[model samples]
Target chain A: MPALVLNNISKRYGDVQALDGINLQIQDGEFCVIVGPSGSGKTTLLNIIAGFTKPDDGEVTVDGKPYNQLSPRDRNIGMVFQDIGLFSHLTVRKNISFGLEIKKSSKKDIDKRVEEIADRLKIRKLLDKKVRLLSGGEAQRVAIGRTLITNPSFFLFDEPLGNLDANLRVEMLTEIKRLHLHLKKTFIYVTHDQEQALSAASRVMIMKDGKALQKGPPREIYNNPIGKFVAEFFGVPSMNLIDGTIIPEEDGSLFQGAGLNVKVKGYSQSKKAEVTLGVRPTDVVVGNQITEDGFGTINSLELLGDKNQIYLTLEQEKSIIAVTSPEVRPELEERVKIKLKENRIFLFDRDQGGRLYP
Target chain B: MSERIKRKGKIPVNIIMLLPTNIIILFLIIIPTILVIWFSLVNFQPTFGINFWQSKFVFLDNYFKILMDDEFVKAVIRTVYISLICLGVEFTIGLLIASILTGNIHGKKILYPLLIIPIMIPPIVIGNNFWLIFSANGPVNQIISIILNTEFKASWFSHPKYAIIPIILSEIWHWYPLTFLILFSGLVNISTSEIRAAKILGATEWQLSWRIKFPKLKGIITIALVIRMMEALKVFDVVHLLTHGGPGTRTQTISFYLFKYGFKYSRISYVSAGAWIILFISLLGFSLALRSVLVERK
Candidate 1:
């Protein structure tokens, strides 16, 4: 059964539409992540789900019941805010026990639950210490513990690891994933970090300007993004986008862009418009000129740990990043050949940034 | 050697930048306090002494005489009584009014000015105006007449109990606005995210306010109370201008007592002692209150 569903939810602030016709359904106990850049309405969508906000139109349903009618206290959903938002004056023990105390649980039950969570989160020694004295990672764990003590059915984490140090963020991501697996609860997480979404979510929904641009498993979304925005948004050094025109090919099609000339494939639309080309950095190879298919030039090179990122200038002053092993890094100003894997090329409508054809 | 040069050049620049503020603080605050302490110890009459050291050594005689005086003791108790009553009324009303004002109500802009208008008037004006209202045949008697259909005209100033009540009311009215502003800012500054976190954790609104918001507001509450308490201790302007220590010394504050001795009776030595006593008591009470409120852990 679908654990949660958002049907055509729309929210507007003044003249700006924050969320426009969002429709989503998550299977029971599935971990779902909404990924986007800033101002993409991902947090607004999370707020609507958490009952912190109400959509101007349409409805949300959880377990086949209307969600908007339920008050936040009655929603029985746990939330970890991006700011950590631990009650600043409470001790760790008090913070974790607050939910139980609110439910009017027995003092013994509250103490036992608080102790159990504290020991699991490894904040047992710090239980009596005030929250203001806690380190960032410790405070974040306490915040998570406070939310989890409620035994919520659905969990909402709004960029919970956004404020942590890089190392701590990775550690927290692992812990959250472990918790999700142990509890088997439906989780709806929001983040602007594409890498975080790729690694943590069962499925990723890429949002752009208040609309879902693409939704799929991480591998599929990375390999076959449905729009120019989605294609350019994922992968480190992102997908290389260069401008070019589509010209008529011999048999019944048009060859789009200069980097890779091929007959249009798979697109069923009748319109044969000029479009831009997209290619991943890893899919494009950079080396000395050994073939004609490669766009050859030497522009700049960056050594990122194990692999070197080679920047090449193709025809029409267009630049592309190609990933190569450190041993293959050519001299700074030396000429080099850049090759494209034919099947990895993407084409997009130049006007609307919509995907055209492979 | 280069690092030494950088360090040397920075030190003088820092001191030079701080010179003006240091000079102002020295002259304005430090110098006056030192002079007050020095003046407390001697028989340095303005007509007799060429310098402070030239004065006769009184050797605690002034302190002894002031401590022994009966009226001085009464003044101290009256001052504290007025302050306690004022603090009670002001803090309760201030918290209630602040919470209401922060609510989503209509026409709050107009209400703010209406509430603040009383605080805007000068202290002397407030005292004099209330003096008229509380007079024997003034508003109080008129209200009594309307309520019971029989006129009762009792002199507010002539009755010691009645006089203290008016003083407390006037001070509460004068200063509750400050408390309201401080507490209102404190409430607004509380992160909404924290409240939401509490709610999602199943806390009701009452628990959210009591456990989360109230505890976070302690620092501001402490600061506001201390500022109000210290100012309330020096409750002189209203007492002096309105009652003039009248109705047989019932409403005499320590400041009025000081004025009557130092300037009115030309007993500068005795009033200097009274001034020191007032300062000592205020400092003691303020420090104790501050320690209990501001310095203690939760």
Candidate 2:
């Protein structure tokens, strides 16, 4: 059974359709991360499920119970905000025990539970300190501990790691993933950073303009994105999309545009006349000599330890990026042949931007 | 030698920049305070054919007289009573209004300014207006008469037992808005995420207020209370304008009592002693409050 299901969720804020007919389901004990750009209604959907916001039309079923009419407190969901909303007036211990105190738990039980949680989160030494005195990563652990002590059915994180520095963010991200594993509870995390989403999520949902565009395991979504947006939104440095048209030939087909011609061998039955050929930067082969596909002048190079990101301008001023071994260093303004691995190229319809060929 | 000269020149320039302010302080504050102290030590009655400097030196005599005087003692107690009542009522009502206003309510923009209208009016004008409203044939009596189904022409200003009621009411009406405005700003400044986190943690509305909102607002609450308490302790305008400290000094606050002695009776020495005592008490209270707030912050 799915732990949480959102059926036909829709919400509008004045002229903005914040969420439009969003349908989703998270299986029990699955780590589901909703990844989207800002204003994609990711946070709005979380708010609706947590009962902080009322959806215009939807049913939020949690563990086979209708939760739409319940208050946030009654919904049994815990959320850690991006701001790490720990009560600054309280000590770390107090902040963690707050939910239990609200429930009027026994003092002994609360104390024991708080100590257990503090030990689990490795913040026992900081328990007596004021929340404002804590470092960013420490405060983040305390925020998670606060929710953990409540023993809610689902843990929702709304960009909880957005405020941390890069090093601290990775540390906390690993800690959160470990926490989900140890708890064995369903976790619904939301973030705009695709790297975090890909690294931590067992299943990923990509949203855009208040719609869930794709949902699957991280690798499935990355390898077979349903549309151009998802394909570009997932990878760092993004996927390179070249505008072109497909012409059916005797053997297979030919994609011709932007001062280059490449044979599309496998997709012989593709009927789309106009298409956008998508390629990841790692798949673009660059060499000193001309290839059958195309050639371009190197604009810049960014070193990424073992690899280098090469920016190239194609024949008609169209730019494309390629990642290659650092050993393939070329001087700026040097013309290099570029070849797209035929099997790795993705063809998307020009108008609708939907995938036309895998 | 050049560096030393530059440092010396900078010191003089700083002093020169502060010279005008120091002179103004000397003339406006320091001189008057010294004069008041001097007057308090001497029996300076202008009613007599003697100037202030020529008055008889009676060290501590005016202070003793103030302590022994029943009217002064009663005025101090009345002032305390009025201040406590006003602070209590104003804080409770102001906090309630501020809390309600902080919610997602419509017309809040319009209502907020309207609520502040009473505070914008001069206290003397508010006193006069309230005096008219509590008059024998005014709207208050008219409403009471209708409610009671009789001609309830009870005189609020002259009744010996209840004469201070109208003074307290007018003071609250003229000042509660200040407390409300401060608290409302503080309440709104609390992060919505903190409130939401509390709710998601299963905090009830009351729990959210006392646990999250109230703790965050402690410093602001202290400031509002201190400001209102100080102003309330100096309650004079409404009492003087509405009741004139009587139907027999029934509403005589310390400020009104001092005003009467200094201006009406020309007992400058006695009033000065009383003023010093009140000032010392006020400073003591203010310091205690500030110390507690500072310590809590740490």
Candidate 3:
């Protein structure tokens, strides 16, 4: 059964519509991630789910029952905050057992559960210490443990690792994924870090301007984003986009733009003024060219340990990034031939930013 | 301090920078404290042409007399009771007001500052204001009569049974806003995300306030309490102005009684001794309260 569902969820802050008819569903025990940039409504959606912010209109259902009217306490949802909101005055044990204590559970049960969660989170030793004295990673675990002790059916993590260092972030990312697998509870994690979303989520939902642009598995979303925003938003070294017009030929059509020309599907809709041709950096092959005229001059490179990110400029001053092996980097300011797979190219209406057709 | 410490091969600028503060402490705090201590030990009744240097030393004679005197003990106990009442009522009302202010109320900027008008008013004015308001024909009796559905005109001043009521009201009115402001600051400092997290983890409204926001505001509440208690313990202006510790000295706070002895009767030595006693008791109370607060937090 679907563990959680949101239908027609909408919120407005003054003039800004924070969430516009947001619709979503997650299967039981599925790890779901909503990734977006700042002010993109990712946090707003989480707030609405956590019952912190009331949406202007929406139906939030968990376990096939409407929970919109239920307070967060009655809804029985657990949340790990982005700020790692551990109770500073409370000891780690008390902080973790907060929900249980609120529920009026027996002392033995609270102690046993607290100990179990502490051992699982590797914070057993710190249980007696005040939360104010914890390190960043330790505090995060306490926050998670505090949420986990309740044994809620649904878990919401709002950028739980946002404050961690790079190494700690990667480590905690793996730990969180493992926890998700172990708990097997529905998880809705919101974060702007696309890498975290890709590494942690079973499914990725990309949002922008209070709208869900696309939702799918991480690999599928990365390889087949529905719009210009999703295509640019998911990838590491974002997809390169160049403006072009669909030039109608007698037989079919050709994507003709600044130093770019390619065949595309027939257009049936009203003629769009401009089209954007997008392809990821890795899709741009170097050295062995696919066709003639599929080449450009090497502009510059951002050095990486294994592969250098090559910036190639074609005619009309349009540049694209190409990942080239460090040993195979083309000479600076010299011409290097680059080619792209026809299937790998994406098309979008430049004016509206919506995906144009195949 | 941090900036000074960061400098390399420079003069000890931080210590030098503290010269003004050191001078102020010397003149304002140390000298006054020494004089108070000296006067507490001597019979320094300045009105009799006996300067502080000439007064005979009586040691702990005044201390024993004051402690053993039933009138002084009663005054001390009354002050303690009044202080406790003010602390309780002020904290409760202040917490409630702060909670309401933090909500989605309108015109918070104006309402907050307006709420502090009582605190901004002079203590003497606060005393007189309550006295007028609680007079036989004043608003208090009028409101009371309205509530009781009867005619009522009782002289709050002449009524010894309720003499302290006016002082309590006046003091709470003058000070609750200070508690409100401090608690409001603390309420704001409590991270909303923490509250949200607690809510999602199944904390009811009461639990949210009790467990999450309350603990987060512990330090600030302690600070507010300490400040309010200190101010309440030293309450004299309102009491003196409102009832003059009258209705037969029923509302005489420790400070008011000390004023009676210190300036009214020209018993300066006894007053200084009382002042020293108060300082000792307040210090003991303050440390005991703070220590328990810290330990409870742990």
Candidate 4:
């Protein structure tokens, strides 16, 4: 059974439709991450799940039980906020055992669980210290420890590591992955940073404009995004989108636009004429030919230690980006040949931007 | 000679900038305090006006007499009692109103300023208005009569047993908004994320206040109470205008009692001694208040 399921969730604030009929099912012990830009209703969905926000219309079923009327105190779900909301008044031990205390557990049980959680989170020496005295990363661990000691059925994290420095974000990312592996509890994490989303999520749900565009494994999402927005949201150098047209032939279709031509075999029977082609930079093959069909000069180059990001303008004044290894360093404004792989290229309709599968 | 001139050129510009302010403080505060102490130390009594040279030196006599006076001791006790009762009531009611104003209710912008209207009225007007309201033929007496189901035309300001209640009510009415404003600012400053975190950790509304919010508001509550304490200890205008320390001296505070001895009866030496005692108490109260503020900062 799924650990949690949201059916037809809808919320509105004045004139803004914050969430529009969102339906999702999160499986048991699955590490699901919602990746979106700001104002995409990701945090609103999480709040609705935690019962901190009431949706206009929805049914939230947790462990196969309807939880629409349950208060956050009774929801049995632990959420860590993006701001690391550790209580400034409580000691580390008291904060960790707060949930158990509210549940009215015995004092001995509370102490044992607090010690166990502290030792697990590596905050053993900080049990008696006030939360106000802790550093940012230490406070983050205390927040996580506070949620973990409760052992809830589902965990919600709303950009919990967004405040940490880059190095510490990566470190905590690994720590969270390891914790998920050890405990096998369902984790639902939300982040606007695409790179962090790709690195951390086991299953990714790409959201835009208060709607979930696609949900799948992270690799599939990076490889095949269904819409133009999701296609652009997930890559380091986002996928280059070019407007083009497809001509159907006897056994194949030829795509031609922006000084490039490609023959695709899968959509010979398709009647689509105009299309938008999206190509990932990694799929563009570069060569030193002077008369190649898809040719452009290097406008600029960014060396990322392992790869070089090449920005080029085509013969039609169109921009395309290509990523190559560090050894293929072309000079400034040097002409280079680019090739597009027929099967790897994605075609979308011109107006609607839905993938055309050609 | 060149070295001396160089040293003189660097004569602390910041200290020179503060010179005028220091001189003003010395003249207005320090010099007057020294004169009050000198006047309290001697019997400067004169049958006629302006005879300071004929005064006799009297060491500790005025202090002892005022300290031993039954009326003075009773006034001190009454001041403390009334001040504590007002502080407790105002703080509680102000905190409640501030919480309601800060809650997600509609029309709060219009209601918030309306709550502070009592604070804008002059103190003397407040005293005189409440004096009329608690009179025998006024609306307050009529309301009390309806509540008790009896003929309650008793003058609330003239009864020895009930005179202090009207002053306490009027003062609370005039000053609760001061505490209300401070606490409302404090309430608005607490982020929503902290409350959400506490709720997800299984906190009810009452528990949220007890654990998360009340601890954060400790400093603001201390500040509000300290201000009210300072104003309450020196309170005299309302009492003088409303009751005039009548009804057998039952409603007299220390400040009101000192006015009779200082100007009416012309026991200037004893009045000065009493003023010095009150000043010492105020200094002690401020010292304790300052220590708490410093510790909270740490």
Candidate 5:
């Protein structure tokens, strides 16, 4: 059975809809991530699951039981907030033991659990210190330990490492991934960082404008996006989109725009007049021309330390980006020919933003 | 050696900037306090108006006389008792009101202004109003008669036994708002996450208040207690207006008794001595309280 199910859940704050018809099913022991930009209702969805907030309509079921009826204390769900919501007044030991104390665990059991978790988190020595005295990473660990000591069946992390510095964030991310592997519990994490989502989430739910735009494993999300929004939202430097029109050629089909013509390779039947062509920066190649029906480029290259991103402008002043190794560097304002990898290309209807061809 | 005369002399700017305030403090507060101390040591006649050099020095005689006097001793005890009782009631009720208002209730915003209206009114006005209400055959006695179904009408001001109640009630009503303001600010500053964390950690309602919120509020509570204690000990305006040392000297607080001796009986030296004794007690009490509070925090 799915460990968590959000069925037709909708939430509204006054006239603004924060969550519109969100439905998700997270399997047991699955590390699911909801990825979105700010105000995309990612935190709202997690809050609903953690029972900090209530959905305006529909139901949340946990372990096949209706969860909306349960209060936060009864939800049996552990939450680590983005703000490291540690009890500032309590000692680190007390903060960790708080959950166990609430469960009415025996004092001996509480002590054992707190110690075991603290030792694992490497905060055994800091236990007697007040939470205010702890460093950011230490406080985050204590917050995690506090929630984990309760031994809940599921864990919900709301940008748990967002407050850490670069090195500590990376360390905490790896530690969280390791903890998920060790515990094997249902984990629902939220973040706006695409790289974080790609690295950690087994399955990612991409949210935009208060709704899920696409949901898939990271590879599928990066390679075969379902729409223009999804394609542009993922990947570093993002996918470059070119506006062009499809035309009927003598033999098959050709896409022509801005004094550029490219043979549409794989589509069996294409009659759409207007479409957007999308290709990742890494896939677009710049080299000498071998054919008459391929797009040419007026290239401008930028050095990005290890690699270079060459901007290709066509005759109509339209630009596309191509990622190339710095060793194969193009000179300043060089004229180069371009080829779009047919299999790596993405096509979407201009009006609806829906994917037409992958 | 002649080159040293050419160097610019240091200007005392720190003293310059503070000179005005320092002079005022010394003249208005510090000098009068020192004069009070000096006056308490000397005996003066009505003819010799506070010329301490001409007046014979009578060290500790004023203190001894006031300490041994039965009326002065009773007044001291009554004042202490009344102040302590008023402080306790005000602190407890103020905390209760603050906590209740902190919760999500319907009329909180409206009730804040309404509750503070009583505190904003002048203390003398409140005293007079309470005096009228607690008079013989007044509202309090009428309410008591209807409840008990008896014709027991005791004069609150005239009877020494019933006099302390009115003073306590008036002081409580006037100063409870100060306590409420302090504690309310304390409650607002407490981290809501701590409360939520406590609940999720399985703390019941009682534990949440006592363990989480109360500890967080210790600093503000100390501030509130000290301020309230100081205000209570100097309980003069309301008592003077309500009873004016009463039908006898039952409700004679230190300040009112000082006023009676200094202005009414023209015994300035005795009143000054009494004032110094009260000041010493207040200073010592605050110092001890602060020391204990700090030591306990360790």
Candidate 6:
């Protein structure tokens, strides 16, 4: 049985639909990440799960028990807020023991647990320090410890690393992932950064416009996106989408437009239709030799230490990016042959952005 | 050299701009303080048929007399008692009202302006308003008469014990609004995430206030209480207007007692000495409060 389940949850704030019929379930010990842009309702979904928000229409079940009417205190779900939300005036030890104190636990038990959590999070030295005096990374650990000491059935993190610098964010992200692995409790993390979602999440739910657009294992979602948005949203130097039309040929269907003509190898759609051809930068091969696929002048080059990103401008001023080894450095305005892997191309409906070809 | 001279000339322009305010301070505040200190060192009284400058020099005599005066000592005690009672009542009532207003109460928008109305009213008006309400044949007695099935024409101001009640009430009514506003803003300034985090940590409503809200509001509470404490310590207008230190000095605060001796009885040197003592005590209290706040910050 799923550890937590939300069935058709919906919420509206004034004229805006903050969450639209979001249905999700997480198995025990699953690290499910909800990733979206700002205002995409990812935080709202996290708040709803933590019982900080109420859904307009839905049922939230935890271990087969309805938790809709339960208060946040009664729900037994822990959340680390985006701001970390450590009590500024309290010492780190007080913050970590707050939950147990609320439970009226004995001082000995609370002290033992706080010490254990502090040692685990490597913040034992900061136990006596006020939270406001802590550094960003130290505060993050303290926040996690504060929640971890409670040992809730599940944990909700709302962009917990949003305030950290880049280096600290990565370090804390690794710490959170390790903490999750050790605890083996269900964790629902929310973030707007695709890289964090991809690296930390066992499963990723991509949300847009208050709707969960796609959800799957990170590798599965990255390899086979359900729509153009998901495909383009995931990858850094995202997928290049070209306007094209699929034409019926004697041997197979051909995607012909944007100065490229390529065979749609596995596409079964027989009718000639307007579609968007999606290709990852790595799939586009740029070389000196002229090929049947197409050719374009090298527009710009961005060096990335080991590899380079080459921007190619085809006919009609259409631009597409291709990743190539630094050894294959093409000069500015040099005409280069571009070949896209046949099976790697994705065809999306131009109007609705739905994937039309595998 | 010319540029340097022009820059140097700008310095006197700044001094000229400040000259008017400095002059006014000298005449209004500085001169009066010096005169008061000088007067306190002598046994000067305008009724002695001589200018204050020629009065007999009696160093520390006025101070000694004031220290020995039973009425002055009692007034000081009464003032401290009244100030404390007023502060305690105002703080309790203000926090309760502020907490309620911070919640999702209906008509809070309308109630916010209404809450400020008491603070906007002058203390003198507040004093008279309560005086009328607590008079012998006033609405308070009428309500009591209705409740107890008798005339209930007991005098509020004339009775020594009951006289302080109206004075304290007036002070609280005129000032609790300020406290409420400060505390309400402080409560609002507490981040929603902190409250939500506390709730998720299994804190009940009371625990949320006690553990999370109150601790976070420590600085703001100190600020509000300090400001209110200073004003309460010098409480005079309400006592003067309501009871005039009446029922035989029963409601006499230190400020009222000083006013009665200084202005009505023309005991300038004696009152000046008493004022200096009060000033020293107030400075001591203020410095202690300031030190505590600074230590907390550190």
Please estimate how well model 2 matches the true structure, expressed as its whole-model Cα lDDT: 0.92
Best by DockQ: 2
CAPRI classification of candidate 4: medium
Better of 2 and 5 by lDDT: 2
* Deviation from native of the Cα of residue A36 in model 2, angstroms: 0.7
- How many angstroms is residue B66 displaced in model 6 relative to the true structure, after the best TM-score fit? 1.4
Name the candidate that leads on lDDT: 2
First chain of candidate 2, TM-score: 0.96
Which residue pairs come into collision in candidate 1?
A: none
DockQ of each: 0.65, 0.76, 0.66, 0.63, 0.44, 0.74
Better of 3 and 5 by DockQ: 3
Candidate 5 residue pairs in clash (backbone atoms < 3 Å)? A102-B202
Sorted into a CAPRI-style docking class, model 1 comes out as medium
lDDT (0-100) at residue B61 of candidate 3? 84
lDDT of 4 by residue, B155-239 (tens): 8778998999888898889889998998889888888877888888888899889888898888888888898888888779889
Per-residue C-alpha lDDT of model 5 across residues A1-358, encoded as one tens digit per residue: 8999999889999988999999999999999999999999999898888777899998999888998978778887788888877877679999999887766779999999889999999999999998888898889889889989988899988998888898998889898999999999999999988888889989999998789988889998998899998898898888988888887666656777766576766653546488887889997777764444355454667888899888778767877778887776566677776777767877788889999775
**Lowest-lDDT window of 10 residues in candidate 6 chain B?**
B1-10
lDDT of each: 0.82, 0.92, 0.86, 0.86, 0.83, 0.90
Stronger candidate by lDDT (2 vs 3): 2
Question: Please, what are the lDDT tens digits per residue for candidate 5 over residues B1-298?
Answer: 3333233576566667789999999999999888888878888646447555677789989888777778777777778888789888988999999999998789888999887777899887898899898989789999999999999798888787878788899888998998999999999887666666666666777878887888878877887888888888788887788778887888898888888887887777787778788878888988877876686466
Candidate 2, which segments miss by more than 4 Å at Cα?
Answer: A267-274, A303-305, A325-332, B1-24
In model 1, what is the error at residue B201, expressed in angstroms?
1.0
User: TM-score of predicted model 2?
Assistant: 0.95
Error of 3 at A299 (Å): 3.8
Give interface RMSD, per candidate.
Answer: 0.8, 0.7, 1.3, 1.3, 1.8, 0.8
- Which tens-of-lDDT digit does each residue in A141-238 have in candidate 6? 99899888778989999999999999999999999999899999999999999999999999999999899999899999989999999999998778
Please provide, for model 2 over B10-68, each residue's C-alpha lDDT reduced to its tens digit, 9 standing for 90 to 100: 56565778899999999999999999999999999988766776899999999999999
